[model samples]
Target: MKFLIIRFSSIGDIVLTTPVIRCLKEQVKDATVHFLTKKNYCGLVENNPHVDKVIVLNESWELMIHLLQNEDYDYIIDLHHNLRTWKVKRALHGVKSFSFNKLNIQKWLLTALKMNRLPDVHIVDRYLETIKSFGVVNDGKVLDYFIPQKDLITKDDIPLSHSFGYVGIVIGAALNTKKLPVHKLKELCDKINFPIILLGGKEDKIVGDEIAAVNEIKIYNSCGKFNLNESADLVRNANLIITHDTGLMHIAAAFKKKIISVWGNTVPEFGMSEYFGKDQVSSFKFQVSGLRCRPCSKIGYKQCPKKHFKCMELQNVEMMAVKTIELIK
Candidate 1:
């Protein structure tokens, strides 16, 4: 059977869908797995061995639909169940489709009503459940991130200070609410005794510079210099990872790196935490408790809704640094 797995955008959410890809390709008899994603994120899965072909949602929606209709897939696994995905399923109307339940109502309850109706299962497990009818199960493995040979980093790519080993800090998030403020990041950097590498996209270069300026010798800002796979290589080489609830965090989990995940407005209970399947990789989450306004949105905001911003301002950076030290040692 041919399976077309759909997850259109973003780094982390697409990374979370790897398990389903693996299971579908491995367990399902003679399965040919085709993945559909936005043009920007085609790099995340284009090199994946499990995917037979990658279909891009390019500038032409008509072209995208034209490409999908030609595949004649046996089933569609909709990992990202948005209106757009609904349209894709509609275009392939006759194909049997299994969609991953997004649990928007449960998310609304937690974020808005402060009611916990969400299942304790991780989003990965929930994603896999979408294909339960096919007898696909979690293979007890880490998330998959395949870096092309050309994109892999060499020792000369990093500074001598971090050449031996360093802690990887993901300094940017999709939204500001999910990020540790620049001040907090600087504080965390100041406290860590180990060599550190600040990672992010071009948009984060200024902030990365600000944080790296805390101690130029100890902190090397690689933001904006490397592409996504190169950044993943940096995360792969790190002695430890200190990150926000971002895509690199998921990539670090893919490498089974010891991760110190810092949370602000978002919580791990949303099931987006670092998942190692049955592997017992050391992972710690730091979030300020007792903040009623926390998780104000299912995703995140540009800034804290509550002016106080206590969800992040109140975090214990000292402890996060201490944990980094402990884990690195």
Candidate 2:
């Protein structure tokens, strides 16, 4: 069976859909799994062994549609049930497709009125639901992130301070409100006694440099220095990871690294947590509870919708660092 699984963009969301891809391929006989994603995120799924082919959606939608039309897939699993995915499903008319419920209304109600009507399920489980009719079930496996041999960073590539083990601190998120303040991160770093590697994209390099300058010997700034796979390689090698609600957090979960994920505008109830199959308890989440304005956005904002920003502001850096130590111990 030739299957076309569509999840357009973004790192974490795409990573969350891996279980569905793996199960559908391994369980269903002769299932040739093809994935559709944005051109930029090609790295995330390109190396996934379960996927037979990765169909990229570049600038030319017409080209993508034309390419997908030739596949003659047996089923279409629409994990990213957005407008573009709807268009893809429409373009491939007559092809049977199953889409996961996005639960937009529940998310909206949570963010709008601070209500808690959302299902108590992880996004990974919800993603798995898309392929339920195929008789594919969760195989008690966690998320998968494969790193190429060429992209692997060895001990020589890292500072001698981190030769034994290091804590990877993912210091950036898609939105500013989803990230911790520079000073707050520095405070957290200051409290952590072990060697720290600040992880992030090129945009976060300046802040990484600023933080690394505090204690150059103990902290190394790898932000902007490595590509996506290389960064994942670092996460794969880390003893633990301290991150915001970002892509690397999901990647760390893939590696089953002890993670202390900080929350800002978004809450973990939206079910995008660090899932390592059933009863995945090693990971911890830190969010300021009892704020009426918590989860102000389903995603996040450039700045807090309400300038108070107490959600992230109130998190105890000391407590999080202490927890990191306990987990690593």
Candidate 3:
């Protein structure tokens, strides 16, 4: 069977589709798995052994559609559930297509009214539900992220004394509302007794540097300095991970590293929390309860709706500090 799986963009969302790729390749008879994602995210699944081909939609879905039209795939697993994938299914006439249910209305209800009537399923599990007809099971596995051998960060990369131990902190997210404030990050770092390493893309470097500058403890600002896989290697080696709801947080879940996931505008109830991991001990949610303005957007916003930003502003930084220390110990 030749299967084409589709998930368009974003780091964490793309990473979350790994289990579907794995189960399809392993469970289906003579399965050849292909994946379609945005060009920027090609590296996320390029090295994945379960996937036979990684096709990138480089800003032009028409070009991708033109190429996919000729492949004559046996199955089209639409994990993205967007207009583009809908078009792809139409073009690939007669091919067995299974699209994941997005549950947008349920999400809208929760975001609009704070009503919690949504199903108790995680998004990853729902992704797996699409292929149930193929007799494929989830195998109880979490997401998979395969870093290229060259990207692995070795102990020698750090100081000889602290190389064996360090806390990996992911302080960046696509939305500003999801990120922990710089002051709160500094407080968390100060409370952490172990050596620290901050991780994020280039955009986070300034914030990371500012946080590093104020804290007395040793903190390595690796943001913008390393590529995605190299950063994954750092997360792989760390004793524990403290992250916001970002791509690296999902990657840490892939690595099964203990995570202290900090939440802001978004809640774990959205079902995008860290999946499969051993000793995945704790998460810190800093949202102010009973704030009518909370969850103004299903994803997040540039700033709080009320402008007070109490959801994140009112978080207990001292409690986070205590949790960080406990995880390290």
Candidate 4:
């Protein structure tokens, strides 16, 4: 069987689809898996053993469609059920395609009306539902993130202070609404007794610097210093991870790292929390409950929809630091 699994952008969502790829390849007879994703995310699956071919979505839509038509895949599993994915399905009209349920309505109820109508299942389980027809069952494994040998960080790459072991603090999220304020981050850093390494993309360097300034010797700002896979390497080597609701949190789950994920405008009840499959790694969620405007948005915004920003502002950073200390021991 020839399968084309499509999950186009973003780090965490793409990482969540790994089990589907693995199950299809392992359980099915003569299965060949081809993954389709945006060019920026091709690296995430390029090293995946289960993926036979990785098709990149670039600027040329016609060319991308032409390439897909030629592959003649027997099945199309659409994990990202968006308009673009719908167009891809339309382009390959004759092929049998199954889409993952996005549950947008359920999410709207939770975020807008504060109703608990969403299912109790995790997003990974829902992604697996799309491949049920093929009898592909999840193999009870954690998410996969394969770092290329060239992108691997050496001991010399990180500070000597962190060589022994350090707590990785992911100081950035996709939006400001999903992250702690710069002052709050600094306060948390000041309280952590253990050595800390702040992780994020280049966009987060300035804020990471502000947080690390709390104690330059104890906190190493690694935000702008590394690429995605290199950052994953840092997460892999960490003693524990303290993160916002972002991609690196999911990557830490892939590495089975002990995680304390801090939530802001978004809540873990959205079902995108750190997953361990069946692993016994410790996981913690820190979110302010009882606020009607807690989960203000399903995704997030540049700034708080409400000017107060209590979802993050009300968080007890001191308590979180205490938890971090206990977990490290």
Candidate 5:
């Protein structure tokens, strides 16, 4: 069977789909798995051993359609479940297609009413459900990330002291509201006894610098200095990771590193937390939290609706720092 799986952009969401791809290829007999994603995200899955082929959409849906229609795939797995995937499905008439339930209504209730009716299942598990008809089952593995050898950052490149141990701190999120404020990050770093390595893309370079500036402890600013795969190597080698609910957080999960995931506008109840990992920890949720505007959105915004921005502003950074210290020891 030839199967084509679809998920467009973003690092974490695309990473979460890896388990489904692996299961379909390894568990099913005579299965050849192909992936469809944005042109830029091809790197996320291109190095993956399980996927036989990767089809990237270069901002032209018609071009993608033309290429896919020629393949005449046996099955189409719509993991993204967005409008574009719907169009792809419509065009591939008569192709056996299965789409994962996005559970948007459940997300709405949780975000709108602060009620937690959503299932306690990770999005990866839900993605696996799409392949049940093919008699494929999850191997209880979370997700997989493959980094090319050339992209790997060696210990020689890092400071001699940090070459032995350092914490990976992800300082960037897609939205500003989801990030821990700069001052709070400074506090978290101040409390940590060990060396720290701040991780993020070019957009986060400024925030990373600010956090590093306030700290007396040794910290390396790796934001924008390394490519995504190179950054993954840093996460893979870290003693522990302190991160926001972002792509690198998911990457940390892929490495099974000890994670300290901070939350803000989005809650873990949305079922997008680190999956199938050992020694994972979260700082965003608390029963003592008596705030009505906890989860303002299924995703997040540029800034909090309430000017106070207490969701991230009030995070227990000291306690998280203590946890990071303990994990490293």
Candidate 6:
């Protein structure tokens, strides 16, 4: 049977879907798997060993739908159950499809009413559950991130000070409230005893510079200097990763790197966390507890809605640094 798995965008969410891809490919006899994602994120799955073909959604939905129609897939696994995926399933006419429950209502209750109705299951497990009818199991495989040879970094690529090893700190997040403030990041950098590499995109270059400015010898700002895969290469080579809830966190899980995941606006109860399948991995989460207004959004906001920003403002940097040191040791 031919399966077209649909997850349109974003780095982490796409990475989380790898287990389903692997199970669908390996367990099912004579099964072919194709992935649909935005053109920009094609690199995330283009090098994946499980995906037979990656159908990129260029700016043209009509063109993409035209292409999907021809594939004549036997089943559609809709990991991204947004309007776009619904439209794609509709456009396919009669192909049997299974969509993972997004639990938006549960998310809304958690964010609005501060109620915890979400299942105990992680998003990765929920993703695996979508294929239970196909008799495919988790297979105890964690997430997959394949770095191409050209994107791989050598010792020469990093600073001489970090030639031995460095902590990979993901300094950027999709939203402002989800990020550790500049002061907090600077504090974390100062407190960490190990060599540090600040990681992010072009948008974070200024903040990276600010954090690395304190001690150029101790902290090296590599944000905006490398592409996505290259950044993943850095995470792959790191001794551990310090990050907000972002794509690199999942990538770090893919590499099974020790992680200090700092939580802010979004809580881990929403089911996104460092998942290493059945493999044992050392991961620590830091979040200020006892805030009534915590988890203000399932995603995040430009600025703190409460404005006190107490959720992030109250985090214990010294303890987080100590934990990082302990994990590294």
lDDT on C-alpha atoms for all candidate structures: 0.93, 0.91, 0.84, 0.92, 0.86, 0.94
Q: For model 1, how does the per-residue alpha-carbon lDDT over 24-114 read when each residue is reduced to its tens digit? A: 8999999999999988999999999999999888788888888898989899999999999999999898999999999999999999999
Question: What is candidate 2's lDDT per residue for 49-70, written digit by digit as tens?
Answer: 9989998886888888888889
> How much is 259 displaced in model 5, in angstroms?
0.6
In angstroms, how far off is 5's CA in candidate 2?
A: 0.5
Worst lDDT 10-window in candidate 6: 56-65
**Residue 202: error of model 6 in Å?**
0.9
Against the hidden true structure, what lDDT does model 5 obtain?
A: 0.86
By lDDT, the candidates rank as 6, 1, 4, 2, 5, 3
lDDT of 6 by residue, 47-117 (tens): 99889999987688898899999998999999999998999999998999999999999999999999999
Indicate the residue-level lDDT of 107 in model 3.
84
Model 5: per-residue Cα lDDT over 39-113, one tens digit each: 789999999999999998756768878899999899999998999889899988989899989998888888887
Quote model 4's TM-score. Answer: 0.98
Model number with the top lDDT: 6
lDDT for each residue of candidate 4 in 100-147, tens digit (9 for 90 to 100): 999999999988899989888999999998898988787789999999
Number of clashing residue pairs, candidate 1 = 0
| Candidate 3 off by > 4 Å | 59-62, 277-287
Q: What TM-score does candidate 1 reach? A: 0.99
lDDT computed for candidate 6: 0.94
* Evaluation by lDDT, superior candidate among 1 and 3: 1
The regions of model 6 sitting more than 4 angstroms off are: none
